[model samples]
Target: MDTHDLRLLANRIRRRDLQAVYEAGAGHIGGEMSVTDLLTALYFHTMKVDPAAPLDPNRDRLILSKGHTALALYVVLSEKGFLPKEEIATFLQHNSRLNGHPNRVKVPGVETNTGPLGHGLPVGVGMAKAAKLDGADWRTFVITGDGEMQEGSNWEAIMAAAHFGLDNLTLIIDHNRLQQGARLEDTNNLAPLPPKLAAFGWTVLEIDGHDMDQITAALSADNIASGKPTCIVAHTNKGHGISFMSDNVAWHHKVPNEAQYKQAMQELENAQ
Candidate 1:
């Protein structure tokens, strides 16, 4: 898709996410807003998957490790026909499969259940390893929060992936700089993250997470280094596309008031 078309589609998905969060009365809206563009670029522009056959073994895999951002993934999945778009209205409602965190078994396109931070990369490594063993060409992509990197398991997986030469794996960090209570720098800095990943023996790319063209370019398979895994540090805002919440730490899981909701909707609609 062209940049203009992808931008329009992203706006539509953002609006859907905004409405779902507003109606659900609770969600990880901050992270959802930050990562929407990355998810849009993947489902709409990068990954090769049939929404009609979400479990097709040969299809590329996506694991949302920061699963609190499942609302973003849900909207993207719906837009890509993996689920009924209307089902999005039920997000976080009682008994809804669309819960606060993605459940791989219940959700069509989700490859793993991950709300506990730092789990996605390891699972992605495993997925890539499986493909290697099976001689399959499918690739695995994962997105996690910068704050989530504080979890030690990610480092373990990094070592394993590098050791195994899992070049089919890609890890994108939503480096928004803010976490739930504080900025990543103040809490536990993972800054200079690209160099850290490189030292761990992975190929590193940095980009504006919300830019479709940049995201697409960085995600391209040709960019993967031979004999190494790929890691893309996607710098982003905690609450992107909405005025009051952008870069605001309090909005990490803050429910928007009615006025804020109306204003956010207007901002998103105006993008088109």
Candidate 2:
């Protein structure tokens, strides 16, 4: 898809995510909106994924480490034809496969079950390593929330990926600078994130996470460094698109009321 179509798809995913969160009465909305564009770019413009044959060994793998935002992934996957759009209404409902966090066992496109802060990269490293061992060309992409970087496990995975020379691995940090209840700077600041990743013997790229062109360029084949893992520090805003919710910490997991939901829907519906 072109950049223009990608934006439209992203807003559609955002609208679906917003309605699901409002209907479910619980979600990490801020992070969901922040990461929607990244996910859209990956599945639509970057990854070699097939909904018809999701288990193909040669397919590109994506692990959403910041799994609290699974609603966004669900919407994107639904739009990509991995699941029926009607099933999205079942999000968070009792016995629904579309739970708060993605379940690989239940969800077709999900690579693994992820919700804990720092597991995805390690899993991604392992997948990349396996592909390398088999001389497979498939790549692994992992997305983590910035706050989740505080987990020590991620640092260990960072070391492992570099040590293994898994250039097939790509870690995209959704650096919105905000977490569940506070800003990352107020907690454990991982600012100057690029230098840190580069120092660890990984190739680092920085880009505006919400920009489709930048995202596609950074993830392009020519940009993947030879013999080194790549990490992208994607600068983004919490609650990215909605006016009142953008960068607001309270929207981290706050469900919108009736009026808030309507306004939010209108804004998403009219997003350029």
Cα lDDT tens digits, model 1, 213-239, are 899999999998888999999999988
Candidates' C-alpha lDDT: 0.92, 0.94
> Which candidate number has the best TM-score?
2
The model with the greatest lDDT is 2
For candidate 2, write residues 1-272 as lDDT tens digits.
99999999999889989999988998889999999999999999999999999999999999999999999999999999999999999999999999999999999999999998899999999999999999999989999999999999999999999999999999999999998889899999999899999999999999999999999999997888799999999999999889989999899989999999999999988786
Provide the lowest-lDDT 10-residue window in model 2: 263-272
Error of 1 at 265 (Å): 1.0
Candidate 2 residue runs with Cα over 4 Å from true position:
none
After TM-score superposition, what is the CA distance of residue 138 in candidate 2 from its true location, in Å? Answer: 0.4
